[model samples]
Target: MKKAIKILFVEDEEALGMVVSDSLRSRGFEIDYHTDGESALQATLTNKYDILVLDVMLPKMDGFSLAREYRKVNRNTPIIFLTARSQTEDVVEGFELGGNDYLKKPFSMEELIVRVKSLIGRLLYSEESQLEECFVGNYKFNIQKQTLELNGKIKTLTYREAQVLLMLFEKRNQVLERKLVLDQLWGDDSFFNARSMDVFITRLRKYLRDDSNIQIVNIRGIGYKLLI
Candidate 1:
């Protein structure tokens, strides 16, 4: 039998916690749910978890502070922030502070499950076996090095940027769902991360601007298509 993935879920709402915990357990995951950031942080230090589902607003300690403390000692674990805030700055702040994803309020359990799976899939396995090099238009992408070479100029990309570029390259000429991308990279499709992703996409566009054949086209409500 496959080993159950362990998750440390931190949320203050009792009803929401019970529902999400039940749903995740039914999906073959082992969840250790906490009601506040303090307990959640304590759990992190003692128990090993594959991923962390954290609520931004928590009693005793906020999710952002908890994540920072957790990252100081264990940096590899993926963190997904759950919050009702949709502000772009807040989303950007989450990412800047080491959050891998963000989910806004009133989200469906199905969407939450999908985001969890996507984050685990990429962080734990898929990313490790990616191709060493990929071609995007006239650009030569070094996945391992996180650099792109075009017209003899090498441009280094941030970790997040590289992940976004790789996703676009894999789905070149195909529309990649915006929510999926956000979840896979940032943990949630909050308005803030959406805006942050747009910034990253723009940076990618600038890097690949020399090659007119390559374009990251936004698909309005759906997502983005990488034209190559």
Candidate 2:
């Protein structure tokens, strides 16, 4: 049998938390639920989980803050933000922070389950896995090794960096949405994760500085386009 997906669910609402937890458990997911951001953050730091479901408002630290802190230590675990705030700016902020997906209050459990399964599937098994190496601009990146080579010199990348670069390279010249990138790399697209991604992008820019023709341009609200 396939292993159950492990989830760290952080929500301040006790009733909703229990309901969601029980629902997910019934669907074969292994979930660890926390009612506050601090304990949730601690659990994430100490344990290994496949995904995170977070609430924006929480005691001690907000969901966005918790997600940011977690990114410092864990880079790839996917995060889904469940919030009652449904304004466009709020949604954008969530994406900016590095949240993979956002579900507003009164969301359907069935939709949540579907989104979780889809996100996990994409992260664990991407179409890019079919190719061993991808050429981005003038450099050749080995996906398995997570290294970028140009002119016989190889530069190793951090796990998150490699994942981001690989995704960009695969979708070169196309507009890669920020949320999609965040979801794929960090499991959530919230403000904190978005800032963390900016740092990673800066590092990547410096690494690819030698190639003048290649550029990774930010498309304002949309995402990034890897220009070759």
Write down the lDDT of every candidate, Cα atoms only.
Answer: 0.84, 0.81
Tell me each candidate's TM-score: 0.66, 0.67
Q: Look at candidate 1 and tell me the lDDT of residue 192.
A: 63
lDDT of 2 by residue, 78-195 (tens): 6788988856666655644556677878889998897788778866785446777877778988876668999999997655677788878878899989999877655577775577
lDDT of 1 at 106: 86
1-228 per-residue lDDT for model 1 (tens digits): 988989999999999999999999998999999999999999887899989999999999999999888877765567889989877878767765667777888889888888778878877674577588988888999986778998789987655777888899888899999999876677667766678998888888988999988889999999999999
* Residue 65 lDDT, candidate 1, scale 0-100: 96
- Which structure among the candidates has the greatest lDDT? 1
What TM-score does candidate 2 reach? 0.67
* Residue 35 accuracy (lDDT) in model 1: 95
Error of 2 at 21 (Å): 1.0
